[model samples]
Target chain A: MHKIALIFGHNDYTFEIEKNIKSHYKKIYIFNLDGQSVSKDSNGYEIEAFDLSEDWDELRDSVNIDECEAFCILEDMSKNIFLTLSLRETFKNLKIVALSQDKESTDKLILAGASKILPTTQTTANIIVEMLKKPMITEVLHNILYEKSNVKIAQIIVKNAQYFDGLFASDINWSKDYNITLLSVIDENGDTEFIYSAKAKHQQIKNGYQFVVVGFERDIIEFEKLIGGADE
Target chain B: MLKSLLLDAAYKINTSKNYTKTKHFFYNLLENSNYKYKKVFDFFMIALIFSSVFILIREVKSHVNDELLFYNNYVVSVIFLIEYLLRFWISGSITEVIIKQSEHDVMFGAEFNLSLALRDIFYQKIRYIISVKAIIDLLAILPFFHELRLLRLFILFRVFKLFRYAKSIQVFTSVVAAKKFEFLTLFIFASIVVFVSSVLIYVMEANNPASPINTLFEAVYWSVVTISTVGYGDITPITEAGRVVAIFVIIAGIAVFSFTTSLIVTAFTEKLDEIKDTKLIDDIAKKREFYLICGYENISKEVAKKLVQNSEVIILEEDEQKAIQAKKDGFFALHYDPGSIESYRKLRINIETQVKAILCLSHSDVENVYTALTVRSFNKDVFILSILKAKANRNKLLFAGVNELLYEKELVGMIAKEFVGKPVAFEAIHALRSNYNGIDMQEIIINERIIESFKAVADLECHKHRIILLGIYKKNKRNFYFNPTYDTSLEVGDYLLLIGNMQFIKEFTDNLHKGK
Candidate 1:
């Protein structure tokens, strides 16, 4: 898959997002709100100025719409929402990720058709800071976020409840036998809970239920194979 | 030897449980604003003072009813007498002074002179008795001594007792009292002007037959009336020389009066801001448990918004505008220097006991670090959470005693990278963390009752409640156990981390409380 990342706006957040996801994309184009008419090169990536008023015809001409994903991260919140709405309108199936300033803007960006809204708010920061107070959870989250560690978080859908042999979810020795930690379970109704939670403990493995697990990629793959393929 | 025995008996009585309890009860009723019944007592005393003074005022015009006069002259006087005696009693502990002096004499192996201790104690009592408040209290009870015609005049002092009940009047008096030097200068200047002008007027106008000012006393009164700008036409100067002296006196009067007015106005203006800040601090201190936010930045504002709905939150910002803005936004905020430790002390934040957490969320990394450090200095165990605005300042924040750090840029970048390809996972994580989709992550603790009701994690029935429990945090080990066996028994003091819709979480916790 030749993945292309179309990032809108240039600011502090734009740089970090581009830098981190640069390797995943075949080509990355940064649409600068203040860019000159001609395309400029910034750190080996192309930065082209584009007007929000334009119909985005130049964007479609420059990149393959099917293979590209849009990032709406304009510093101004209203502009970010406008860009998300424009991108969603032009490309019916484009995966648009938006950076929202707060809860109110998050709702606005969602209504503007952002596929995923990443809240950049002190409230979110406060929640994260609180979670990081736990030493083990902090290390686990840090590994998943910053480092290029082999540890990965993946979701597996249950295809056969018979695999558990009528035993409860807690009956399975996940980490001991499969070397994969069962983080949480999401039912067909989309209600998710930690596998170890009091409510999830005695639950029978039901078909179509998704299990979120964290482990090395090799272990996750092996565990998925043993449990049968996902719902798809 | 007899003196020591007598002193020992007096100390015993002073320290007796009954005596101390009676004294404490009266002290709280009369003086302690924090006492539950203090307001009631103040109201009763104020009403009594007003009625008594009203009776006295009415007595001058017409004869008051005999019954009303009897109550005011006898009952009101008795109450005032009791109040005065209580005030004098709680003013100072004489027995404490004598015992302390005796202890000192023993420590130094010196001769204990009973007379010296007595003299020192006498001065302490005399100081309290001669105080302005004490004098008013004494005069307020003089209606009982109406037999002495002169003492009957002191009944008007009952009105001054109103000053004790009204807090605003006391505050105004204190503010004015703080400008003692300025008031003293004005007094001296006015006295010199009055003397010089009165001497000149008496020498010039006392001989004028058409003038109202004949006696030296009348000339002195005329000069005072003119300098005060009252300008009573009855005391006009007839002589040309006398009129000139009056002109100079009038100009001096304006200067002196204006100076006095400005002095008081300046004092009030200077103290008003301080008074406001102190009041805010006092209001915050009343909260048994509150979150103390160090700054009113965007993040802290968000934090305060979420917490303020369910709990008390106080925002301390160094910038006056930001603090005022926070206040306008309907949060408890005070203009205080967050970076300075004095701000915490000024707020009287009992970090370990009262404050649930201290959040240092200033826009600047330096400010957050300094605030965290200041808070940490006051309490070693207070949970200090700070925002690391820049990546380079992580170590500095950690070293400055921030227990938890939220690096906004790093988290945003990482989340963006992680979810760009997987939309489902992105939505799930976002829902779990932020209010983007109304789902949130919360922690619930298991107590003895919860342990008793549900022996194992499976018994919680989180699935039925539609809430997800992620793991159990063991209290003793301070470690989280993820994906425990279904039969994993719960124990008291274990924290369960759950992720679900807030409504579902509420229902789940409510069910747990119901022990279902």
Candidate 2:
């Protein structure tokens, strides 16, 4: 049961960001700093409004900043940096994530002691939107966010393995034996080749190959032991 | 020892690299009609056939010089004989390459052994030699055998070879083949009408004293002439019953003629349209890479205009006027609803394997999202880039697996900010956005091969090439290094931002790939 604090200026993106992430948190405290005359409640969720230039100590006390996860989504880069610096000063381990309008501000946000920075670029948004469109991507995202599944991606290097030394990719029963999906292979030349590609199907597996596999953690461990190498 | 030495020499000739290269060249020229030199060969062959026909006709009509005609016939026959032999030699390799290069297993079925492969190649060669084209080629040289008077008739077969040069004739034949059932139905109906009319007239006129149709054959001939509206008048109906039957037959003849003509006309138009569509799809599919823009709005038009100079662009606009305008402006525009699967099917989206990206530039965010979803459903791996107007719709589009998203408001705000504070930087950005004197900025990924070939940044010689290396974005560190030092070495996944003239950039990229 994690409590979250969302700080936003009067921007259309804030509402969308808040709506998408609200379900993951137990309690959400939205602080609107634009001081616009708007509804205090959004679908039974309360929004607290404040002035642009405000006393940080008073706001921190009111929001119980130390006990909550904070999201800084200010529209202006400088303001977002200022808010992040202030939050970092107040609590060293607050786990503050800030939004940046561009690449240059992203560096500033990191320097301001934000635990994470999300660049509000259309490219980033599009990628996320695209992933949400696919059910498989949604399932993966849900699993990662909620810790609902043990499936993880692991890159394992191949050492001396007699069975796999000279066998084509199609000849190997990776999923049946190890419960792993062989996504790709990185050869000795550091070129990544998709396992299912026509060029890769005839490729003979050899030593010094790095395999990127997706499977349960225990199965990955078992596969690593069988291949005589640790996860990269 | 002499036999073994000769066998060794034969093996060397068979396995030599130059021999294989020559074989490949001849195979391409003879078998692959799409080959560049093959067109020239086809034109030459057509010219030769026409000249031979003219000479043959002249010999038949006028008192041409016997020696000149004989010499012309001999030279053309020899050329045809050589071409026939070359085609036969290359047919085996052509069959082998087709089997080896087909991407789908459905075409060739399971792989066969070496002996079976050889047998298949032999069968293919036999089939080719017995084909209509081969018969014509053989007939074109038959007149040279002057001793055989019967073979003189075979010389006319050169006219059949003209079908090879007429692509429309092949298309028309295929259309007729496909509509054979409809044609048979019309033929049966017309035959029934003629037979019934002939029988009725024969019955009515046989017993009439004043009837000219005394025999059934003469009555049938009269019906045939009247039904065709030719009215030969060699036979005529005399009685009232015969006259009434003739009137009905004439009316039926006109109706059936018009119906048959309209049917043929409609079928031809439909078949031609279908052929055009298939040819367009085939041409687009053959392209290795192209950009598919979903809308023909102002932004999309600008994007198409910019990309048209160096890259292939296809626009799918639902608005008929816009699509027509786009075509008028020299862009390939297809009027299709982007959201519908049927439209995608018509476009043969699934078969277009080399589509580099689909850009959804619709004004509505929802429409863009729908287009992205539809395209992704058809092809899971194609990169989808969409322009989003509203921030609220970002999550939906991101979930749809759009690889690139351009926010209109964000871009506008950034440009505005730059314009107010840094005018020079703004101008530079503006210049890069639109082509300024053929100069523009392009971002290229540094792949593993590039990293290995060029160990240091200085080796690229951007200065000598008149190109500027703006910055390098290191993927691993997620850091942008502006104006990297000459000693700095690039890594795999680094993006090199370069500014140069289009031609120079193309050459530089080519040279980089060539490891020059």
Candidate 3:
């Protein structure tokens, strides 16, 4: 179970973010930006209020970032950058999903200690690419990602795994071995392609939405289990 | 299991490893599509239908060996028969075999059935004329069946069948037939002019030899050409009386021409211009206010409208060229591919952050999901109403942080039940649709005493103004539930979504505001 911190700007969006996160991570702390017209009544969700202008120490002490698996700032890059820097100083291994307002903010967000800086522009572009390629498959994708009934979109960026490369999708059998399903790929170019390679017994580095996937919440635990077994 | 079996069967019929080969086979055998060679074939058929009949007639009269023409006639007849059979086969008319299909088709069936019948009771019907023409054509080729000489003579009415090849001629004929009584009244008035002109021209041109107008027919011909402005100068009266007649005729010609043209043009141009300008775009900003451009790809038009309920939209379009056209169509347009977060920024999407959410409709699963993903990445808190195009993409977008998901197809289907049949629903909704082009159809609930009395939601929205109530989609979900009465009382925020013409919709809104 990843301990994640989600900081959002709007009520509805915050509510949705929480709902999305609840499926993937058992523990999540959501913080909403102050002074927006959104409220509990207007927005369909309860937003955990937080001031963006708060001192770094105050924010850290308030949110407790030291123990989190990931810190996601679903807001403008400048604010996200501040949060990333604040969180990085306390927890160096913490993965950050820092939302970038524009492409210009990406490099700075990374420099500010974000492990993952998802620029809004790139996400939207990759979305379009995915839609154009497999036009109607997004419905199935949404069913898994948004609904808490069974699945979640989790990412384990291929790194330091010699055995991970050159394996077909079917052969991966992540569901059987690790209780996860590979939904799509997000390539290095910010392009997204759906992973429908049922015959694919091998996998390669294909950057796109095709690499992103729906998997059981326990898949990450399964991954950690394998890691523990390897260590022993 | 049944669904899978059907899908497998459909897949076997349609899909192929080599698409080109499959396409060719289907194109030649099933489709019989004349797409690539349309222009060439259309002209060829036009020439063949008329020229062949002409040749057959002339050749048989000259006694220049009849079998070829007869054989050609039968071959063309067989082709028509085959074509008609294919049309009937594909139309699946058996499935559509209700008692009252097209009267025209039924009439045609009656004529054919009657002509072939031994008693020939079809000859008693008014449509029997068509049967007679077909009979004549059959007779024209009867040399193969050892029929006598009366078979080859084609009547003037038989030429009408060739009019099917002429669209303009068919329109002319139909119009002429419809205005038969009016034409008769016009004929009486025209004849009076003809008679007066004849008498006057006779008195004046009696002294002139070059333009001798001694007869009524010559005078009538001149009168018609001058009045109609055809003015083919084959025959005319040259005397002073003729000049007087010509002036009256020429003026009449211009008047008649203008009258006919005005009537037709005025009747059709209003709807035609509206259709021409009607186009689909994702976004358009009105009055510098941000708006959501909704598409089924990921959004519903209704929800899109709801998302931006009292806000203006700088309608962002997926294509810049489409945006330009939308601009020309009187929309405040912004060009940005909603799927591309970069396009949003590059197109100054954030520059006008005053925009309401770009409600990616959930019904358009792919587009809605993509738009949501991209949009959340940009402004995590922006309200995005997504319409799930299908049930599958719903959860994914919900996870992606879509504010709302409204299914348009399901909505339209649900509303269709309110109508007895498709025709009634279409006619009622057409006004609503027309208002959306450059104009909008928005219905609001008014509690002020200025407007007329209202008990039910429909009364407040549709009863007095008679704007077509598309539905009663409440804003209570977005706001507080002010009007909780399931029976009637519309509270402040509850909206009455009605569709009406632009003028009426505007007037209706203004009245609601004024408390009228």
* The candidate that achieves the highest TM-score relative to the unseen native structure: 1
**lDDT by residue for model 3 (B409-487), tens:** 2333222211112222222223223332333345465454533455555344443453334333345463322122325
**Model 1 per-residue lDDT tens digits across residues B1-516:** 877796797689777999899989989898866566888999999999889888888988898999998899899999899889888888878777778778889899987668888898899899999999899988888779765768778887988988899888987998888898889889999999999998999999888788888888897899889888888878889999999998899999999879988998999998898767667765765688887888887777777877786788888889989998999999988888978877777777778878888888888999998888877776789888887878889999999998888777667787787775443444445445544445656777888777778889779876566555556778688666664566899988888877666777888888787885
Leading candidate by DockQ: 1
For residue A119, what is the lDDT in candidate 2? 56
- Expressed as tens digits, the lDDT of each residue in B1-516 for candidate 2 is 643443355456656789788888887776654456877877887888888778778878787787767765687778877887887786666434334433233366844334454466677888988988888877777777663767767767877776766667777777777778888987888788889888899899999888888887887788778877888777889888999999998998787778777877877887876887767766665566787888777667666766676778888888889988999989988888887788877766652566767888888888888988887776787878888888789999998878777775554333322322233323333344344546555667888788778877888877566565655667577455545677888887777766556787888898777785
Cα lDDT tens digits, model 2, A1-232, are 3465454554655555555555556676667776654566555556677654665677666666666777777777888898888778768888776777666788989999988666555323333333323323333423422235555556677886576768876456555456665655667886655554455667888888777665677888888988867543
Whole-model Cα lDDT of every candidate shown, in order:
0.78, 0.68, 0.48
Identify the CAPRI category of the predicted complex in candidate 3. Answer: incorrect
Ranking by TM-score: 1, 2, 3
> What stretches of model 3 exceed 4 Å from their correct place?
A1-6, A20-232, B1-48, B56-63, B68-158, B165-192, B206-211, B232-234, B257-516
Which of 1 and 2 is the better model by lDDT?
Answer: 1
Q: Which ten residues in a row have the lowest lDDT in candidate 3 chain B?
A: B416-425
Q: Please give the lDDT score for candidate 1.
A: 0.78
